[model samples]
Target: MHICHVNLASGFSGGERQTLTLIKQQLAMGYQLTVVANPKSPFADEIRALEQCQLVLCKHYTRSHQRSITADCDVVHVHEGRAIYWALLQRLIHGVPYIVTRRIDNPLKRKWLSQLAYTRASTLVGLSSEIVRQITLRHPQANVATIPSSPVQYPVSNTDVDAIKAQFANKFLVIQAANMYAHKGFDVTIGAAKELEKHSPQVHICLLGDGKARAELEKQAQGLGNISFMGKQSAMGNWFAAADLLVHPSYSEGLGSVILEAMATGLPAVGTKAGGIPDIINHETNGYLIPSGDQGEITYAQISVNPLIPASTICSK
Candidate 1:
């Protein structure tokens, strides 16, 4: 089958990573794969690296649709919101079958229009059961499929892992690998770090990834010397391996891909008990989930800083 995937966002994030993983997996399985994206995007470069794949440079087609995109492929698998408009347009204009993957927790709040837009799609794939439930609750008759965004086949280099491990050797490092967003609770993670310092001076918090909320998060971390903002880095597997634990205190999440990535590296996870996290993270098994918002700080800090719990226990589950 000829499958084409499209997303407009430039930088690499969870959704972008998911797109790359799906495309690579499909290509390995002998499917004809092509990506419709910006030539300058990391997605474009990654897709082009695949010998079996083809890429079409259609940068600004996100807001509206073009007949050419849907005409050539048998199946159009769309990821991210920008591609959703294209998916619906294809169905209305070209009679092409398409599937969308909803990877984020907060579905747009505009109910009627959002419902209409989603119901019009051929099939909607939710990255977590909570997302599927939310969609069904909104449009009772809407068709939504549940599929966990599987862990990436993370490449681990021993040299890289050792280097990062040495950088934060003495500190009991707590890392949060999430985009810099309000919903991601980077502020909350920093708050927890500051609160933890009152009782435990040895604990340290590292915020990973970059986003619009960087300035605000940095401002919040100002007085908190234990909290360090590392910004965005392409190499994360080694950091995941080096960190004492991973904490995801999002107000909402589709599946918390970082949680699985941390678990795969034998690192424990501490996240808010919301969305798809419950489906994968067993309380006191691989990780701990706390209530959303302010209450999460206390719960997350305690779980993350605990010395009794070993990171190795996370991978076993």
Candidate 2:
């Protein structure tokens, strides 16, 4: 079987990483694979060296020119938002059916083209049940399936973990790993850190990721010593292994796979009820879920996560 994966993201992020993982697994399973991505994007660089996977550069989804590959494909899999129209066009012109994996819970525009593209797809997969619900709400006839993104469980040496722990010694590490985007709700973290600094001097918030919003978020955290932003780090597993808690207060989320990664490291999470965070977090059992963009709730949640406490009981609703 042949599978053509399309991911036209401008930069590398969680969704692109998931797409890359899927392509590698499918190729290993003896499925011929082709990937459509931005030539300059980090995702393209990662996929470029993969054996048996044909990397087709589609800088812009609309201007894509891959009719020959579409003709030979057994299945067309769209992995991002802009690629939906590209796959729809291929299905219309070449008669190749495509399935879309919608990675976001943001509602689709109520337009004819958006409706047509979704309804025409062979299947629409959501990273979580919440995303599935959002898809159905946009188009009731939309065929949707829920398949959560898998965690990588990145390998890390004990030395790296110990080093990270030593860097933040004597502090209850509250970590957040996500692109510093506005929708990621960095404001909530800043607010929570500001409040926590007043009472819980031992609690420290460490954000690990960088984006256009970094400067703005830094300004918001002005005069705060309890919070620190370390640009993007390659040693995610080391941080998770060292951290006491992971707080993801995203205003909008697809599946919150970072939460899953933290859990894989035996680190608990305090995520917002937004999007598919509720899918993985069991509310006081595994982790906690609070209102999206609630600064006070985040502050309270961080204070509750005692570093001395074992990984067994982490957070609550």
On TM-score, the leading prediction is 2
Off by over 4 Å in 1: 62-72, 109-116, 295-305, 308-317
Each model's TM-score, in the order given? 0.88, 0.92
Model 1 pairs in collision: none
How well does candidate 2 score on lDDT at residue 70? 72
Residue 70 in candidate 1, Cα distance off native in Å: 4.5
- Candidate 1, residues 1-317: lDDT per residue as tens digits? 88878877776678889888888788788888767777667877787787577777766644436666556788788885767766666677777777878887765456564555577877888888898887777667867889898788677788998887677777778888888888888777877777666756666777888889999888877888787888887788778877887888888888999898889888888888888889888987777877777643544445445674455422211
Clashing pairs in 2: none
Candidate 2's residue-wise lDDT over 118-158, tens digit each? 98999989999888988898878767788998886677889
lDDT of 1: 0.76
Q: For model 1, what is the error of residue 257's alpha carbon versus the real structure, in angstroms, after optimal superposition?
A: 0.9
